[model samples]
Target: MNTIVSTYNLSKYFNGICRVNEVNLTVYEGDIYGFLGPNGAGKSTTLKMLLGLIKPTKGNMVIFSKNFNKNRQLILSQTGSLIESPSYYEHLTGLENMRILQRLRNVSNKKVQEALHIVRLEKQQNKLVKHYSLGMKQRLGIAMALINFPKLLILDEPTNGLDPNGIREIRELIKSLPQRYGITVLISTHLLSEIEQIATSVGIINDGNLLFQGSMEQLKAKNKAYISIKTQDNNLAKKILLTEGYKFKQNNDRLIFEDLTDSHIAYLNKLFIGQSIDVIRIEEHRKSLEDIFLELTGKERSL
Candidate 1:
């Protein structure tokens, strides 16, 4: 778990406002680190600084133990990134674009072919990039990133415009990168389920501050056992459930219990029956990544 990247008091300011505060973080080897936040939460800004696309107004940034300013070429050679929407030469064939990128990086032609194969774009190598579908274009962008055979891959919303099938394909591809190619990944996205499915660890940010950072199991453990109790008298069930010292919230016609042990739930069932409440159903709910995000980020939607 050696550090692949580290930041000390990193801050990015635009027009005298700090978009990225004095944030410190570390990324370990072979990790699929999820950077989660809302649309304007400085996630992309922080990544730009990490990739040296934008300079930090304060503090220092390091990649693979090399300071970004002094050793950028050395560090960037082993790093690949696709930030926001990737643009490619529309008229150039996929293979031609790859060849151009390889020549620019001084990577070999064989490496170019290998990268195309890795992203499953070899079959369409002769097709012009503009003719490719949204998913195909995204795959080609990924192949371009892989051409360098980077030790670290940084992607900003890698699956943004992908279909469900496209999303699953990229999901599988990303999950295989660390173990198969010995590459570490830093991915940012607003999609919680995508991160939950693939990321080994996560860092949640809001208003330029780190809200939570840990393994998936640790984040899931933050909330107590969730139970969904459905009854015809929804209001009564909610009132009774809350009165019994069980913290609960209302979801449609159901009462969502935040913390309730088995015995307490059983007693609740008995009490509801005695009170002439017809119980429709009682089921335990699994707290999803969205639930964890909302809990950590204060249960509010922010633009």
Candidate 2:
């Protein structure tokens, strides 16, 4: 796949404080790239630099294989963005709002209609923006971005305040964009579960530092699996495991074996039973995306 966007050591500083530090990012054509980080993790700052909304304090960026500084307009022409919140003329009808944006982008009215339809807002296109729900407004923001048929879409926290159903709608819309419109997307969010489901690749950032960046499969592969065994006599189980040279850790009433395989589990179960340890339960567990996120970013909340 061709790299549609690439940043080399991109850095952004505010008042002598590093908001984005030596960050490198890659987004390929036809990819749904998830930019994930906790709150204040430089996600927005990096995106601002990428969109030319702000200048980078250090390093540089390349979009469509052209230098960002020299080709700002050319790069932005092919990119559509909805950073932070969606803005609209609340009194104007959705169709009217779209028409205004269409005029600004010099795109055809047909493109406006097509964008509204893509976001599933065609039925409500004539309704006043003030009557639209928050979710609808967000969808409309995306519609505005799509009015010009941009090759790349950058959305920051697009699902910030939607209900579950609204989130699902936006999620499905974003997932389909790359294939349906042939547009690459760079979406930043604190929602790890959403990323795990829809993103082809992920980049994790924390405190202005890039901790992890890779395909979803590669990220999941980093989620370590373990055999968790509970027993009637935990102390006895631990003693047996130790004597048998099985490496493990104890958590409350359970023992966690990180390097255990299926065979090891079976053998351990049999051995415990033979030693009268009275196994209560044994199950395999793997870290969820949220678990991995917390571990990597060292943050408790999803923000």
Candidate 3:
């Protein structure tokens, strides 16, 4: 895959401390690259460096194959972004806000209208931004980001202040960008579940370090596999599984085997049937991205 964005040994300093240390990133065309980390994990700092809003202390950053530091105008023309909260004139209507951005980007009013349609904010185009809910404001932010029809869109926590419906809307909007508009996206957020649903690839960062970078499927596959089996005699099945030397976990009435193969499962089913133990259900339990992240990061998260 050809890289649309690449960073080499990128480092940023704040008060002589490395905020983002020796990082490398690759974002390909037509990819929604999820950049995920906890709060204060240097996500914003790295984005600023990439956008040339802040100068890097060491290493190089390139966008669209151009060094952002040297070709700032060229990069800006091809890219659109919403970093942090997008602020608009409190008194301005949604249309007005988009018009201002379009003017600045040297784009047409039709482009602004198209962007509003993309974010599903066309009906609220005449409403004052102050009257818009947080979710609406986020949609407007995305509208502004799309006003230029940029080849690459950088969104920092695109669903930060959205409600469930708004989050769903944004997720659909992001997913449609590559196919509908031929736009690639690089989105930064701490919401792993959201990333799992929308991103084609992900880069996990923590404590200013890039821990892992790969597809969500690849990350999920890194964790151990487990086979879940439900039987009439839950306790007896658990006992049999343990006695048979299968490493397992108990989920409600189900006994899950950590390393059980198809043949092993079949054998267990036959044994249970012979013993008059009804086999209720059986399946391979696939680990989620969150499960893999917990194992890799060694951190516990509560719902």
Candidate 4:
């Protein structure tokens, strides 16, 4: 796949404090690359630098295989972005707002309707921006970004303020872009579940530092699976597990084992039965994306 966006040792500083440090990011064509991190982890700062909204303190970036420093205009022409909340003329109708952007971008007027249709806002194009609901406004913002039919779309927290249905709608739209329009998407968010659903690849950052970057499958492979077991006699179960030298941890009223085979489970069941200890429950537990995200970033608070 073609490399759509690439950064090398990308760093940003504010008031002599490094907000982004030695970060390396690669986004390939046709990929929905999820840029993930906790709050104040430089996700937004790095995205701003990528969009040429702010200059990096050190290192450089390349977009569409062109050096950002030298070909900023050329690169930006093919890139469309929405950072934070979108700005709009409250008095203008959706169509009117699109017309303004069309004029500024020097693109054909037909693109206005096309963008509106893509965002499912064509029916509401005649409505004033101020009257639009939060979800409608967000779709309008995306329509504005799509008016140019950009090759790469960068959205920072696109679903930030959306309700569950709105989030689902946006996620579906974003997931469809690569297949329907052949557009590469780079989305930044603190939500791990959202990334797990739509992103082809992900980069995790924390405290201005990059922690993990790879395909979702690779990240999941790093997480160990465990089995939770509950027995009628917890004391006897513990003694049996200890006698067998099995590695496990006690959580509340259950014992968890990281490495347990089907045969091992069977043997344990038989052993318990022979000893007249009832086995109440036994189940395997796999780590979720949120679990891995929290562990990798070493943060207790939710994203």
Best candidate according to TM-score = 2
Tens-digit lDDT track for model 4 on 1-303? Answer: 899999999999999999999999999999999999888899999999998889899998988889999999999989899999887898999999999999999989788888999999989999999999999999999999998999999999999989999999999999999999999999999888899899999999999999999887888888788899899998998998899888889999898988799999899889988899999999899977777888889875344
42 Cα displacement, candidate 1 (Å): 0.6
lDDT of 3 by residue, 1-303 (tens): 678999999998889887898999999999999998877778989998888789899999888888878898999888889999887887999999888887788898789889999989999999999999998898898888889899999999888867889899899999999989989999998888888899998998877888898887777668677888888888887677678776777877778677777888899999888778899999886766787777666664322
Clashing pairs in 2: 39-303
lDDT of each: 0.87, 0.92, 0.86, 0.92
**lDDT ranking, high to low:** 2, 4, 1, 3
Worst window of 10 by summed lDDT in candidate 3: 294-303
True-structure lDDT of candidate 2: 0.92
What are the models' TM-scores? Answer: 0.83, 0.92, 0.83, 0.90
Residue 189 in model 2: lDDT: 91
- Model 1 misplaced regions, further than 4 Å: 226-286, 298-303
Greater lDDT among 2 and 3 belongs to 2
After superposing all C-alphas onto the true structure, candidate 1 shows an RMSD in angstroms of 4.0
Better of 2 and 4 by TM-score: 2
Query: Which residue pairs show collisions in model 1?
Result: none
Query: Candidate 4: misplaced stretches above 4 Å?
Result: 230-255, 275-281, 300-303
Summarize candidate 2's per-residue lDDT along 137-185 as a digit string, tens digits: 9999999989998999999999999999999999999999998889999
